[model samples]
Target: MWDIIKEIITYSLFLWIFLVLSYSNSNQGRILGCNGKSECPQRHRNSTINA
Candidate 1:
């Protein structure tokens, strides 16, 4: 009975750690756009023609 409880706790801790690491890694790509458009400044600049 005690072994089963210990196993459950160990698995829960591992799952929590895995979720935290994955969330932090993916957060780097998060960004915001101005003018209520989905375009980023870099992409918008590339699409415009000076002439």
Candidate 2:
């Protein structure tokens, strides 16, 4: 019983870490249409082109 619980927790932690890493890595790309051409100036939401 304890082993099963431990396994579940371990898997959950790994999944959480993977999700967080992927989200952080792709977050900027998603915001910039995911085309991979987003630059610093265009990242601002308040900017004319971005807004």
Candidate 3:
């Protein structure tokens, strides 16, 4: 009854917060050049092609 509803609301809130935090973290990683190897501009600039 009311307890079930409360539980559902609490779980949903936690899930929403988790998602928001993860999304922001990923965005920060991109801004800080922490993305994958091939997609990082700083890495590309510091490495030589050796061709």
RMSD for each of the candidates: 5.6, 5.5, 5.3
TM-scores, in order shown?
0.55, 0.57, 0.54
Candidate 3 ranges with C-alpha deviation above 4 Å: 27-51
Against the reference, the lDDT scores of all candidates come to 0.65, 0.70, 0.73
lDDT for position 46 in model 1: 53
* lDDT (10s digit) by residue, model 1, range 1-51: 999999999999999999999887763224443442335453346555432
Q: Which ten residues in a row have the lowest lDDT in candidate 2?
A: 36-45
Best by TM-score: 2
User: How high a TM-score does candidate 2 get?
Assistant: 0.57
Full-model lDDT, candidate 2: 0.70
lDDT of 3 at 24: 77
Ranking by TM-score: 2, 1, 3
Clashing pairs in 1: none
